[model samples]
Target: MSNSKKKKMPKGSMETFFKVLRMIGNYRFLLILSIVLAAVTVVLQLYVPILFGNAIDEVVGAHAVDFDRMWYYLSRILVMVIVSSVSTWVMSIINNRMTYRTVQDIRAKAIRHIQELPLSYLDQHSTGDIISRVIADTDILSDGLLLGFTQLFSGIVTIVGTLIFMFSKNVWITLLVIVLTPLSFFVAKFISSHSFQMFRKQSETRGKQTALIEEMIGNQKVVQAFGYEDKASERFAEINEDLKNYSQKAVFYSSLTNPSTRCVNNIIYAGVALVGAFMIPGGFLTVGGLSVLLSYANQYMKPFNDISSVITELQNALACAGRIFELLEEPAEVPEEKKEMGKAAGEVNIEHVSFSYDKSKKLIEDFNFESKPGMRVAIVGPTGCGKTTFINLLMRFYDTDKGDILVDGQPIKNVTRHSLRSNYGMVLQDTWIKSGTVRENICIGKPNATNEEIKEAAKRSHSWEFIRRLPDGLDTVLTEDSLSQGQKQLLCITRVMLCLPPMLILDEATSSIDTRTELQIQEAFDQLMQGRTSFIVAHRLSTIRNADWILVMKDGQIIEQGTHDDLMKEDGFYNHLYNSQFVNVAQ
Candidate 1:
């Protein structure tokens, strides 16, 4: 019963890293080309120090200056500079193209995988967290990959090339630089590992904060109505502060890797200068050889700084990749062979159905029921009494744990979900209206609905009056903010009316509108319900008094079921609910 949240490091971080590398496998040709270009640039870069050192030897010791030799080396250096710059530019272009395309493939796969995931996964996670993985996490990974190409790869080439040139000048100096290399790596390794953990924590905290912001903004109306604005703001502030602290610590630790490695390089530089001064007295090395050794020494240490910085970026990229991989690994909905259910006969049977969100608490146990074609069945139950769960089962949003749902004598599981859901039209208590023209919103389910058909459906639902009063009639743009709650409910009803499916589900569809509007809309609903098998979950008992069958459910069991009058005569749970509402209305 403790309320503490556990911090979970993404499982299989290395495995996830390899999976992302495989995503880039398709673009290996471009990656190899970039490496070749980078190698050419590093060769030209390493030659410049050698050319300068030899020119100094030709001019420095003699009384007369060797201007001709100096000029020749300078011209060669200029040519190398231009070629190196062009090669570097070309490599950058190739690397960026490869990185972005790889990220594009990953994001598309994640989105497609999301479609195959079960609704249970979405219900457990937040909308903003899912969006963060798609947008923010992918971008972070790409940035890190790009840094690898620009800095990490090129640094390794420069370091190895510098070592080769250094050894040719003098073995003793080369050995000195080699011995100090491990010290630089030791410093980098110690600092970057600490930074990696901080970065991972920072990424997780960001996802949590983003989810909170989306939830608070989406429910601002309820927050204000309940006078909880201060509480909401305080909650947001707490998460925001947590993110700030985590980000600061991650950046601070990552920043230390560069300077710490550079410090080791500086100490090695002083050691080399002292050792070379002694070698010069014995004529063991020439002035030019000593100068070349010093230049190569600086070149060797530069990569350590570059690599330490790249390590930070690599850690961030891996953390984000871990999140993306986790999303891709989610268990998809059970795949079944597509079975065409041509046209449903609208007969439904719940045969000994049992279900539970949690195994310890059974929500629906051995529920059994049957409805004939074209029967209007009204299901009455108190809140939390498995009302919506019943509709969810029929639509195949969820499969029962132990029993089968049958439509037209065929198990629903055998039918393709797309074709099965298409045969039924639904209007829930919560209305969903996208930002578009009124015509578009009403015809979403039936895209080919004509203007005449749209107007006819709207008129039947009594929604046309308000829609026509708008500036452009059917063409007028309507967002959720533009329409009243009742008008949105009417539009939802109009959509079902337009589809005219053989089976319909209305879950408290008229709960938002006023009494007069409800009565008007109910008349339209009555007309629309003809010849259609409809299942209605209603709290207002009066609206369903004329249903062919009334099912009174309590605590996941159907205690009484018959025509409305028959249930009333029994004076059971349904009678008590109906009489209570009547008494409330009279008062």
Candidate 2:
């Protein structure tokens, strides 16, 4: 591992612990009930050893057996045992209910918060990492919390109740137990301190492993196409091995805590026995009292043993909590302005706009442009030359760092994001088709669109012919196997045609279709762009040959702007680019 990656781990903060406590606000009554039941159960259980010791004295130690007294104590013990069993069962029910409910609330809140977070933040983090927090981490927390509530609460009650009984019977032995009690805590603290970082590392490694798996699986086609399946497998193996190592180290350190504490506890038990033996013969304590003291000693240290073992789970829960809180606390997207916009006239103006992914390197700088309504403006450039950035700014997927964009002379930022985006329809190269019927996918552009309107749009986009040939026509369930790449792009175009927005953005929209289909889709696109202002981002010079204006972009600046024929006559960059593709095709 690299040193930078091995930087100091953040301690599990009390703030995170208490914040989780606060999340149980709605389930407070159930939580309190569970605790009360646990405490009562423990108290009732403590009476077992006391009553049994008295019975031992009355039955086994006495010269003449006191049958009545023995029966009386045994009856009370029997009654207490029944009550404790019932209480323990009820407590488990209530505690689990409380834990899962609180966890459900946390998951809901986290998911909602994720939705509101900025696109920039989502782009920077892995989807698998985010999913792990929602699913895996929350499950870990639920387990730890359930264990803490059931075991920790009852354990403390048992320890405190036992100590009081022991002290009343024999102060010397009780004091010794109390003095030696800190040893268990010391062992727990030492082992937990060492293991916490390992648990944190384990969690981080698991997230990375999940991310790699998602990436590889999502791009399995690409990996196989390039014959890189072995390479991908090798990479996954490396991450999986790291997760195993981290998990092993974390488990090893946590395992040390329980056994070490048990060893100390055994010594304490033996010491108490020896002390009680001496005190009994010294005439300081009765035989029955000595027997009760030994039982109390074991009960008192039992809580320490149980808690020591649970410290590992508790620490792991805390580590998971820190990650969850970190995500919850991330800054969300800036609130959109509330101003409503009127019907857009399809005129857009970019005035002195500047932007950069990073501040150190500006990609788009002080750029200016204007498009009158109903103009087909084509933007042509090589990859990474800011064609998409222009579209991003226009759609406000990203805001310009320096200047403003205006639609129909109204500043884009001044209007609500929903209203702004509603005026434009987009069809990108990468088609997004959900697992739904064909009609459902096309109606996404206009949720309330009628069946007649949907079919009309599909017909106009040249997709209805293919849709009718399917087994169930428009009602067929869509999946990856249900359609080809070209067919998917045609469906996307059908969706946009259904909406018929005031402006259109075609970002390599026809790149996936064949030459014949591309020609048909282009004619359909011409009809769609008749009255709406359109921005066409294309590498195929043929797609923009008839554009009213063509902007030749290079390194974020507009190197040339003219009609396609005008640019071709100049025989500059645009001319060479347009001719080069034709030459390659001719050969």
Candidate 3:
């Protein structure tokens, strides 16, 4: 439940590469338009180089200045340049929209998938790791798609167009450039494959760093109180060092793309120049024709160069997307064609129940119990006993391995979880407060609760005094430190008081409050529990003395069960616990 555990990630190259391509499938028309615009830009730009070469042919050094003809080509060149620029600008706009929309779709899907994941999965992973997948990874993926979408099609068209035009000018020089193309690709392939692994490690390391930062920050008070600041800093430094190494290695390998491929590309350019120069004196090629070959050579190799850089971005993008895909691909909660069976009549039966977190170590075995309508059943136990586990089972947070939990004669598994959970008003030893107005937090259990009803519940739970003293009373927005632990617990109690369901589960619900308020709350709960069936898990022995039945648990089994008087008369495990609790309190 500490470090995040996940399935082994696939080496995402062509698989994730194509997955990104498929994201734009819904916008085929825009994609086609972008390609068309790209082709138009490439064609126009390719023609300009030829025009410039012809314009050069119109000029000769000694009375070779043909101003009229040169001006004509220059004017045509100007028009083409403007058109290409405008086309690229508009195409960029289309690319941005498609890229951001695709990223948004992925992020939304990841978040929705999170809601469907089982509690067991979330319990095993950290909050920061999940946040990194949902937010940070998607952002990096967007940058990669933008580069790919803008360059890929244009680069391909430029490569083919340059070769055809170059061949028309001179076959010998064209073949030389063609012969050298594979070398550039081989270099790119070698570097990109290795860089992909580094980037993947970098993403994983970032997740760890993010997880650690959030954990330490969220529990800084505890860390300081426990005098663990130095150790915490040391742990953070180790993760940060790993992050630095991975990032540097990823950047170093990815950076190799440009210089390595450019080295190959530059050789191809020089080869074309050398071959064309030798052809000039043989009357096999003119000066203008040689310039055309040079231009085409650069144009043809430019795509490979651009793509090499894009490969680095693509590697990083794929790495992040791979992490996001892992989360999306996780198996969701078992889907059932559920019926929302609303409130229960407070009749619960647990039959032949056996459970464990691990199969080798059984926690609860062969347990059987029944609570009739309006029964106040108290579960008391030592720290390692199955008290909290019992509450989780009853709430269907985790299902039993060997038996059934029934409410109102219907199995909980058969009903929709929302409806089943709605049947009980539950408060735990751990209090939770979400961001919202004070009124909203109280009414979370009963959203449409009236003002008078909220005030009444708050007053009964002894939380109304703090509520009244606040700046805006019920309308005041609640922040993390806005309420004390006791105040937060009081609000949690108030929520249950407002709901007042037919069944209740209170697990150490008043542990944080002072003794005076606990007594006041007990009096209020006495009135509230008049006809409702309740399950109370408490460590303080005196508080549950009035319970209809008390079960003393040890390991996972009930060692003693009876009313307070009955258990004392038996003088067994329950009596020992009761006597020890009073002795410790006296000390």
Model 2: runs farther than 4 Å from truth? 1-15, 60-62
| Candidate 3 stretches greater than 4 Å from native | 1-6, 64-66, 167-176, 278-285, 310-312
Q: Give lDDT per model, in order.
A: 0.86, 0.87, 0.89
Model 2 Cα lDDT, one tens digit per residue, 1-587: 43213334464646667877888768878878877998889888777888988898886644789999999999999999999999999999998898999889889989999988866677778999998888888889898888777777788788889988887888888889889888988888788877888888887888888888888889889989999999888988998898899888888999898899999899889999898888887799877877788777778888877877787788788778777877787777788757987779999999999987766677988889999999999999888889998998899888889988999998898898889888899999999999999989999869899989999999999999999999999899998778999899999999999999999999999999999988988999999999899999999888899899899898888889999889989999999988998896799
Taking the tens digit of each residue's C-alpha lDDT, what string does model 3 give over 132-189? 9888889999999999888888898899889888888888788888888899888888
Per-residue lDDT tens digits for candidate 1, residues 1-587, read 11112234465445766787788888999978987998899989989888888787777656877899989998999999999999999999998999999999999999999999987678778898998888888999999888876886688889889889888888888898899889987887677767777777777777887888888899988989999999988988988888788778878888898888889999888888889989998999877777878887888887787867677777778878888888898879898797878778799998999987666678988899999999999999899999998998889888898889999999999988988898898999999999889888999999999999999999999999999999999999986588899999999999999998989999999999999989998898888788888999999898999899988888888888999999999998888988998796699
| Candidate 1 lDDT score relative to the true structure | 0.86
Flag regions of model 1 displaced more than 4 Å.
1-16, 64-66, 167-172, 271-284, 310-314
Q: Which candidate gets the maximum lDDT versus the true structure?
A: 3
